[model samples]
Target: MKKVIMGNHAVSYGVRASEAKVISAYPITPQTHIVELLSEMCANGEIDAKFIKVESEHSAMAACVGASAAGSRAFTATSSQGLLLMHEMLHWAVGARLPIVLANVNRAVGPPWSIWTDQNDSLSQRDVGWLQIYCESNQEVQDTIPQAFKIAEQLQMPVMIVMDAFFLSHTFEIVDIIEKEQVREFLPPYEPEIKIDTADQHSFGNLAGPDHYMELRYMIQEAMDRGLDVIKKVNKEFEEIFGRGYGLIEPYRCDDAETILVTSGTVSSTTRAVIDELRDEGVKVGSLKIRVFRPFPTEEVFEVLSKAKKVAVIDRNISFGAHGIFYQEIKSALYGRTDIPILGYIAGLGGRDVTPKVIREIADKAIGDEQPERYINWIGVKI
Candidate 1:
């Protein structure tokens, strides 16, 4: 059924469709509505689930961890500092191999205080072993929840569904809401091989000694290594059933393009418009939206980008001293494979608007410069 809803409610509907058994979250700006609606659904019997209201984001995730450990489909939502508070439990979810799904509205981390969109919060948890999917629209955001659950259960790893704060979270759009009946066709009930059971008890996340610790960590890496294929398989199955498929990396008009812009989240939509405008004027530029961040999609990214003359990455999140997070990943992916000039542009930090003019400027620079003057470039910064 089609319904006009904001991104947060879209997430709630996704969780509803996924039939998550345990929904636990602490209210945080931009992300609160996601769980708020789920709470309502639970209360009204629209969803047969337990909506656990917790005090802090830490406790929210801890509650999810406990629920997921008990072999239930678990979920939660948070943004910015709320996400940061859940850092410890996030690692716990990954290390324990519990298939808990989290919807993280991408908000900028605060010092001076801001509730706007950015990738820093989720990016900061990059190495924690969660499969991260960044959504471009409310429809994708809603669809990804069930997909994330399927992917997580199959891999026995947690998944994070990330969306831009306010941009995708507060903004209303028409989404073809995937009903629970349809989702059940694609994502089956999660049945884990081993779970915390009282009758047939098994030790989970027990202390790992020096002899076995390395191997445990090795297995985690192994799962990550296999994540891409599993995600692709799940995506294909979802597309077959739902008639919509979002690949790991979506390359638009890239077959014969000279320059390609890399982006994620809501920025990808704006970048696509810029690409079309530039294309009409005879500029051979394309855009690549990275839907999946973890598992990196190195081979797929390389294949699409190697054909381009220049590549520019527009990052909404930066890694302090190093460079843009996606920029680093893109460069690493294409490092030895191709020496094409891959430029990195840090723009739209702290919810600043990444307008077409800004994207156009980056594209023009990338296309105009035979060799980029610097690896890292900042856009729309005041002195």
Candidate 2:
């Protein structure tokens, strides 16, 4: 059914469609609507799931870990500090090899106390071994949930579906709500060979001696390596069923372009508008929206970026003292493959509006021969 829904509720609907057996989350700004709707669904019997009202975000994730270990399809949502609070447990979920899916409404971290949209919160958890997929719209956010479950359970790794805070979370959009019956075709019930079964009981996350710990870590990496192909396959099957699909990375009009804008999340929509405007002005430009972050689409990124003469990455989050998070990943992806001057522009932090003009400025800077005065340029900063 087609419906105009907020991004948060869209995720809620996806969880419902997935037939998730356990949903536990502590509400945080711009992310509360997701769980709030889930709570109502539970209360109204719309979904056959247990909604655990946990005290803190930490406990929320812990509960999810416990439920997932018991072979339940677990899910949760959070933002900014809430995600940060779940840091240790984030590791717990990964180490335990549970297929819990988390929807993180990307928000800026605190110091000045901003609750607006940014990718820092989720990006900070990059190394925790969760498969991270950033969304460009409400539709994608909703759609990715069931796919996340399939991918997570397949690889025995948690998946984090991230979206901009207010930009996507609060904003409403028309989405084709995939019915549960159809979603079930794409995402089958998760029945892991290993679960907290009393009959076939075995210890999970038990003490591993140093001789075995390194190999276990290697196996996780091995799963991540397999996940790249699994993700593509799952997305392909999803499209076959739902008629909508998103690739690992979306490259727009880059075939004959001299420069490209690299972006993720809602900001990519604005970047697309800028691409068209520049094209009208006789400038060869394009945009690449990174829908998948973790299991970073290295080959796909290399293929698209190698064609462009120069690439400008617009990141809404910074790694602080290093580079824009996405920028670093892009460079790493392209390193040793091409000398296609991949530039970095840090914009939209703490929810600052990254208007089209800002994107234009970044594009102009990227195409020029001034050689980017610095590795990372702060776009739209007043100072």
Best by lDDT: 1
Cα lDDT tens digits for candidate 2, 1-383: 89999999999999999999999999799899999999999999989999999999999999999999999999999999999999999999989899999999998899889999888899999999999999988899889999999999999999999988888999999999987888878888878888889999898887899999999899899999999999999999988988899999999889998898999999899999999999999999999999989999999999999999898899898998999999999999998988788889899999999899888888888998467636678887789
Where does candidate 1 stray beyond 4 Å? 370-375
lDDT for predicted candidate 2 compared with the true structure: 0.92
Using all chains and alpha carbons, the TM-scores for the candidates as numbered come to 0.98, 0.98
Clashing pairs in 1: none
Clashes of 1: 0
Question: lDDT of all the models against the reference?
Answer: 0.93, 0.92
Off by over 4 Å in 2: none
